[model samples]
Target: MEVLQILHMNKGNDETSYAQNSKVQRKILSVVKPIIDEAVQKMLCSNIAPIGSMGIADLGCSSGPNTLLLISEIIDAIHATSSCSTSFTEFRVFLNDLFSNDFNTIFMSLPAFYNQLKEEKGAGFGSFFISAVPGSFYGRLFPAKSLHFVHSSSSLHWLSQVPPGLDCQAAGKALNKGKIYISKTSPQCVLEAYSLQFHKDFLLFLKSRAEEIVGGGRMVLSLIGRSSSDPSTQESCYQWELLAHALMSMVSEVNT
Candidate 1:
């Protein structure tokens, strides 16, 4: 098997299977961390509910080092909020990803993660009830009005799959043309379709969270974004093009 096929097989149908895309994923998280912190604090202070406790969920939480890094930031923020609030409140941290994801990896790693935090940062900081629940964040993943903060990074923009036929040739075309994703002149229809899917996915996210989060609950999302809303710009989608070629090459090799 080629390297990509091996990686895909390792994925095993998990949402977090996207872990293979680690470099870009980490880049996405780095850019969004500060924004999430601010949003969480605002939610805690807002007038929607008593600040006695908080529930924070990281949607599309993939397993690995990056997940741990994200949880650390969240724990710090929660502790800071708990310290300043007059009412004592506990904290719940939900790590959510697709059912196909390696939640087992997350669970197995948690004790170690917790131990490291306690040893490095001290135990008295913030009390966290950490749990990993398997589910797709593309749909509702929490109880209604149950969350105080929601955060996701690098995940929101990935389409469940690239548009169908995106890999297929025009019925009569040959592989000699040698391309799979964007060409110099992909029709506007394809771009618009992808954009529409993003919009729909984003709306579902908002709607689900609207009810799951209390009135003052805050959401912070950071994903790979376009330089602008223009759909036709190559700058906005160069990575998708590269990934397609990579996948296509893998498929070709596997069949041969």
Candidate 2:
């Protein structure tokens, strides 16, 4: 719980904050733009089309330039594909993140975002209703069939809590020593616990999203992950292994 207390990006436009270090996420979104465009195009053309308004949610939307980028792209796609048969009159965009997220920063930067939108799409480019939604994405966040499109980027690695492990070497002691997550020396049980927790979390995410999205709605998820099944594999965990080595080397130097 103590760790959870401080689990948010740094506030303001600081050098060491998520706002300044999210270019990689922006590029990923650019790479997936075609996919989003196709999905939005199809959703707009669906028989149960967007009538008067459309509901869109950007889950795990950190405060920064990236906050409104997804919504902007979605709006562009819809407008580009719009005709007499399919045209939007309004948009309700939900910016979702954890309770600890830097929401104030987002609100502060919103004036610029709106101005940009207005300049690009005109003042009456479908009444844009933006709101903040604070919560974990592991459970239901919206009403049933309430969303037309949902997007999350550069998240999904964070667990809601420490995964329960049965194989404690001693009471309240972790089986994996001196490692925050799966390591080369971690027992098989540690891997199992982490995997089980991931499974449960992913299942919960799907169940919750299912209740919120209509049949033809679309969801895009971007996460930093590996393709390997083995947690200790080099390609899967070299970053952590290198970090552990660097930290241990520093400690050894200090001890000596």
Which one is best on TM-score? 2
Error of 2 at 33 (Å): 1.4
lDDT of 1 by residue, 1-256 (tens): 3211121213423554545447677877777777866776676565556546678888878777677788888776665665444343567889887665666766777898889878865776657789986766767888887787788887776655555554456657532244443444566655665667677877877888888887767788877655666644678556656876798899899999
Candidate 1 regions with alpha-carbon error over 4 angstroms: 1-21, 86-88, 161-183
* Residue 32 lDDT in candidate 2: 86
Error of 1 at 156 (Å): 0.9
Give me candidate 1's TM-score against the actual structure: 0.79
Candidate 2 per-residue lDDT over residues 1-256, each given as its tens digit: 6434567877678898888998998898899899888888777777655536788999889888788788889888977777632456878899998888999988987888889888998886577889999888889899988898998888788776778763356556759766667878888988888889889998999899999997778888878777877788878667877787788789889999
For residue 5, model 2's alpha carbon misses the true position, in angstroms, by 5.3
